[model samples]
Target: MAALLAARAFLEIRYLAGDARRVSEDRSPEDDLERIRFLADVCHNMPGIAQPRPWRPSRRGAPGSSVQQAMAKRPMGWAWHTAGPEKRAWMLRHIENAGLQWTPPPPLPARRKGPSPMTLRQRAGVLLGRWPVRPPAGHLSLPPEAHVLKALDSDAICALYEEAGRLRLGLGKGGPWLRAHLDADSVHYLVPDPASYYWPGMPSTRGEIDWWQCTALLRMCDGEQVSGMVAVLPETFAALPSTLPRRKQVRLVHHARTTERDTYLWGRDHKAECDPQLCGFVPETTGDPPPDD
Candidate 1:
């Protein structure tokens, strides 16, 4: 029974050291030494095991006799080997907390190739608004061109023309109202018709020339609001020379027929309003434009 218990303990030690080979029945002192050396090697090589620092003597000096003092200076594994079961168990717990374990962690699963075809389809559907198209609550109609001009004074009209010409020269968007300071006293303004979609340098949309002619007359009264109207046709608006003067500025405004202020107010009040569906029709320039007052 004594031999059996010793063999069991030896096997347990061997297992901790990760040695699978069977132990010899007639093991010698040399064999025991070799087993201890193997366990020391295993503990040192374990990933999370901390390196043991040299034990220091107390301020009072060595704790015991010269023989005991020498033992204290020996390697940590030497103490571990001589420790009782309770001390050994405590050391094993510390080892576990340090992440030193017998078994390795499992490998991670492989990643997928790419987004599936169905996912791509769903994304396309969302972008095109084909999946769920909601109609707008109220349609914003443009007032007649006469009404829009009546709201502005002659100075405002000139400022609009100068600024619109400047924007046309630079091919950029003017904030709020299109404005240009032509010297201190000279400024021009023009009501940009938000219904026109200007795609400069591209082929003019079907009936664009006729639509502009009618709209220009309606907005500026054939150059009555400021100076002569300059129609920036697709090619002209896009590739016109930067040196072109205010005389060459177009009287057209491009976008949905709604002012920035009106759009902001509408969005603020009707938070859930759906975006209006864009119909390819050019708006009529004959009727009274939407009321600005």
Candidate 2:
């Protein structure tokens, strides 16, 4: 039973470590180490981490330290009194293997520094949604060696909107998005930070910087979330000497009409009113009732 429990416990540790790695996120090495230590608690058969069940807990019982009791007698397993080198090495190895930067933690001054002061608090904040809440990927920095357009003689660009209440909802009323079509299937979307998705480069580009700031708008070019929108954002379509070399053939498009595919709803605008008088009664027999057969 001990051996079996030990195997299951290690399996969970590996599973947890793997999960941490698989997520498309960056975490500090200290964070991973803290996780490793808590897992050690599983091997030690400590409280809060009760007897193994499904990885997702849906059962209730007194927490058992059967796994710890089992590991204590196994080869190279933890003993109740030993917080030794073996345990420390085991933790460091897992962190390193997970491809995160691991600095050697400072030597303990004979006092076992269980989990750090911030560890459990950080975990709590994560569960409570107070931490690691990623804000919208707001205007990420452009890639190095960013693409700059000398001119665009054959690209059509404009704004797109879903109809019905698009004007009321003001989909493109802010910093106007500059959409471009490089091909029949390649569509690129661009918008200034404080511009309108509904309006073009008018008051949106009247600000200090337009072209450089709204250069790259990464997005799904294909119908599904697959292709990216990539094109240059030109402020004005003028041909003065200074702006001649910069002027390109850009299509200035206006919103046409809403399509059948625009699945817009006005439920909020047209809600059914409730009457207190009608609440207590079933509907009265309309007009007449048929004679009983």
Work out the TM-score per prediction: 0.15, 0.16
The TM-score, computed over Cα atoms with residue i paired to residue i, of candidate 2 is 0.16
lDDT of 2: 0.29
Report lDDT (Cα) of residue 79, candidate 2: 30
lDDT of 1 by residue, 1-293 (tens): 11222344455566544433334345555666676664454343232223444544321111232333443443343344555575456456555655665332122222221111233543454344331111122322222221122123434434433444464432222222222111223323333232223312223544322212111212221121221232322332223223322222221221111112221222233323322232111223222112221
Runs in model 2 deviating more than 4 A are 1-91, 94-154, 157-188, 194-210, 215-222, 226-234, 237-293
Off by over 4 Å in 1: 1-150, 169-191, 194-196, 199-293
Could you list the CA RMSD of all candidates, in the order they appear? Answer: 33.2, 25.8
Q: After superposition, how far is residue 288 of candidate 2 from its true place, in Å?
A: 77
Local accuracy of candidate 2 as per-residue lDDT tens digits, 216-273: 1222122321111222234331221121111121110000000001111111111132
The top-ranked prediction according to TM-score is 2
Error of 1 at 293 (Å): 28
Candidate 2 clashing pairs, residues 3+ apart or interchain: 172-197, 172-198, 174-195, 174-196, 175-195, 175-196, 176-195, 176-196, 221-227
Give model 1's TM-score versus the native structure.
Answer: 0.15
